[model samples]
Target: MKQTPNVIVIEDNDDDFEALKFAFEEDGAPGLDIERCTTGPEAEHALDRLRDRAEISREDRVLIILDLRLPGLSGFDLLKTMRHDSRLRRIPVVILSSSSNQSDAIESYTAGANAYIRKPRNFDEYVDMVGSFRTFWTGCAELPVLG
Candidate 1:
């Protein structure tokens, strides 16, 4: 079996997604694979594919970095549905949105977001945060990986 912790970025911003992908690659975080899905439905379908391939398991550390404002199924809706799903409820979900509203932050945590991060306005700050994320998730955290 071959597995590593996986991160799924669920945001519609193509530019943001590409930037993040590049940043992660630049950070040289090995043993981690990054995946992207532009929409909630697309993410769901991708998750299904992963499951079919036996890539995601009950012990997999599948982190979801989501944007609150989406075109169709909003991040809130996706969070709610994921929480209700038995198979995916345990996966860590982090809200990474540009919204600065307190209510959005409150609702995200209340609705079971593991972490709520405001999208950084500065480019350097954004990269720094992603780098910090890599450090924490890959270094400090004892994430699940396949044998």
Candidate 2:
């Protein structure tokens, strides 16, 4: 049986995380194993654990939703680290941030982020954005198999 994709959300703010979770739930994206990491270091450790899992199979998929401004280790640095690790490089990373800076977007892509998305201003917009996101990432896009 194929395992549902795991979504690792790396965010520091509790409100933002709750909003995202609510949005996904409202979007009716069931079967997704959503996990959260409050800090960049925590995310890094979790990713390393995933990578080192001996039982991991090719059917396992992991998608990272990263925030740019983290408590420690920054998103850019984490992206760079992940890109350099062969075990982690294939996993897709999407940047979800509040910054509208073009430089941040550019830097994210340059550092190996698969996509960059700004946070929506309203709850309705967030729901709509998550709906589209779920449709594309979970339904339309073909993600790489980890491990």
Index of the highest-TM-score prediction: 2
lDDT digits (tens) for residues 37-138 of candidate 2: 999889989877878751467677888999999998799999999999888988889999999999999999999999999998888888999999888888
> Which ranges in model 2 have alpha carbons more than 4 Å from their true place?
1-3
TM-score of 1: 0.85
Quantify all predictions' global Cα lDDT against the true fold. 0.78, 0.88
Give the range of the ten consecutive residues with the poorest summed lDDT in model 2: 50-59
Considering every candidate listed, which one attains the maximal lDDT?
2
lDDT of 2: 0.88
Where does model 1 exceed 4 Å of error? 1-4, 50-59, 144-147
